[model samples]
Target: MSARLEVADIFRRHGEAYRQAHHGHLGRVERRVMSAIELCRTAALGGHIEECRACGAVRVAYNSCRNRHCPKCQTAVARDWLAARASELLPVPYFHVVFTLPAEIAAVAFQNKAVVYTILFRTAAETLRTIAADPRHLGAEIGLIAVLHSWGQTLTYHPHLHCIVPGGGPSPDGSRWISCRPGFFLAVRVLSRLFRRLFLEALRVAFEAGGLQFFGSIADLAGPAAFARLLAAARRRDWVVYAKPPFGGPEQVLAYLGRYTHRVAIANSRLVSLADGKVTFRWRDYRHGRKTKLMTLKADEFIRRFLLHTLPDGFHRIRHYGFLANGRRVARLASCRQLLAVRAPETAFRAEPVTDLPSLTHPCPCCGSPMITLAVWHHGQAPPPRSAWNDSS
Candidate 1:
């Protein structure tokens, strides 16, 4: 009932019960995620001590688990990632596009995350490259940054990829930049068709290669005939590929990336309450004019929903492709800037170094003076008690 509520609070209180209830079905990644979130920023992980120079006020700070799924650990990580991406922006217009899998395919993806998700990323990227490369469309090689998200507003499993792309790219001959029409980026209908066909074909190949696994309710899909039927049904419907209008400029693109790049299923700020075996949070209803709404679920159900989004270990959720692919990014970017006759942004993109000591940049609450690190401690070691410090001073 405190003013400060977190997913950690819910996990610490009810996670064990959920784990025991689902022991037969719980996964290693999900179990680790729950443990990491529950122990994050607690004495169990240990941390450091800081003191105010002006007033001699001291405080203890705990270490973060730094797990990607922890809501408490993503802010600084996202900031650093955005900083690295700052210099990569171009002066031209940028567009936002989304590729979504249908519910039937999404169900299979939920069962086999790594293979299906990888296929989704590759097929989505290929769809754009294939369509944009055609002489009829933009006639230029393009680049994009794609981020994968597995949850919808209410924490439902809805796998999709959000892509940020420049308005155009260097010509196939490496001669010059080719921009699209003033407001348009690409044809969604064309993109949707290709994405559907490519994804189904890739899924078929993966199934044939024994790269996919089906279980429980969907176990029947293990058969070639059943799997063929699933794909055939998916083919009958149009896949969703949406492209928003071009951004006002590069600045808007950076802002959008900040919100999405390191996001978790739900943020701590959205939490409303945890009481009486229920957890409440805020969500938006996109189907009904984006209306704001609140959802409350049993504490156990909340934990289950949160764990549905644990990514496979070592999986990279964010990726670059085409001219922005990791290997070609630098040279291609320099060439694009030269062709456009534009200089890189005035601000330099430098990554701050990691440090264990508390930063002196934060002002002390007691004296309004800088706080300096007084001591450092590692896991399993506790700093001196407050009483001991006060007595010594």
Candidate 2:
């Protein structure tokens, strides 16, 4: 049912030694991630037992860790989340925009994730709002959904914001919905300049207010002179901001983000091999037209690179801003519907009772009858003697 190497195999084989070697250095959250991946889908996490009706067959389904960083757990989670937002889709063109951190700033962010990443989110949102509201542009309040990604194809610490935006927005007075030109959203050059200014200014505030810290090579930045120099260097660098062609419909936006929102540093399908304490995987080198290439790294080194992307616990990686803000989303969306001359979604699509929904369980393999759950298995339980049953965590 599966092909290619997986990250789970790597963890199951080498996790204990890696944990012991870095015992004192690993953070609590990192430790939790390791445990979750190692125990995922194994008897260590237990299983669900279902018996067939006519054929008298039995099925055992193991529990998943459901950790945010687990590759195997994201598909179902993404589907459920996207379904919830399906009714919110306005029949408007959508755009995809990316705001990235400059290399010098990225170096600092590599150390201070919580503080710097928060600033990245706030400033990117502010830049979009400011530019879209200018008379030279659309001159309306815009709304966007942004997801944070901290790694690049090569698994380097490259932090960037991926934003799915409507081509236009509601007027400041909320009287009408504004639409941008057919093929253009906003100029990437303009977005880049504005985003750089706002982000650097915010970074300066964070630095002066003692909200940031310097470590290792950047430790000299603890002094005011060094910090100023670093800021000046980052200012001279060109920050990257780009927008893709407008999407045909709102569902396009949902489909695009469903693939992005829940991914980790890498997926198991990309893994090629693990042998001689070295791991090989596939990656895309964007500098060369995104050609696929294989990369090899020591097992410990690969683990280190993976851990670099772990976010501060409880941080919400996906965010909504402007017209889409939760406080007024319903009213704002209602106004958009009126302006666009689209009727409200039918009751079947909105606020339908859960009990009326179709069942999610699997059917009997032979008889097509809905299988009944026989027992709930908990981790660490001593199994009662039974034939044809083996503990599969």
Question: Number of backbone collisions per candidate, in order?
Answer: 0, 3
Give the lDDT of residue 339 in candidate 2.
81
Which residue pairs show collisions in model 2?
41-393, 42-393, 43-393
Candidate 1, poorest ten consecutive residues by summed lDDT: 384-393
Collision pairs in model 1:
none
Candidate 2: lDDT over CA atoms?
0.83
Model 2 worst lDDT window (10 residues): 351-360
> What would the per-residue lDDT of candidate 2 be over residues 1-393, giving only the tens digit for each residue?
656677788887888888999998888888888889888888778876776665777777788999998778888778767776777777778889999998888999988899999999999999899999997988989988899999998788899999988888888887888899998988888889888888889989998999998878889988999888987887788889989888877657776877799889999889989999999999998899999999999888888888889888999899989878778888877888888889865422233224432222467877887665565677876433355343332
TM-score of 1: 0.95
Q: TM-score for every candidate vs. truth? A: 0.95, 0.91
lDDT of 1 by residue, 1-393 (tens): 446899999999999999999999999999999999999998888876778878987777889999999999998999889887998999999999999999999999999999999999999999999999998999999999999999999998999999999999999998999999999989999999999999999999999999999899899999999999999999999999999988897678888998999999999999999999999999999999999999999999999899999999999999999999999898999999988989888545455766664456356988799787666667777766655443312
* Candidate 1 global Cα RMSD: 2.3
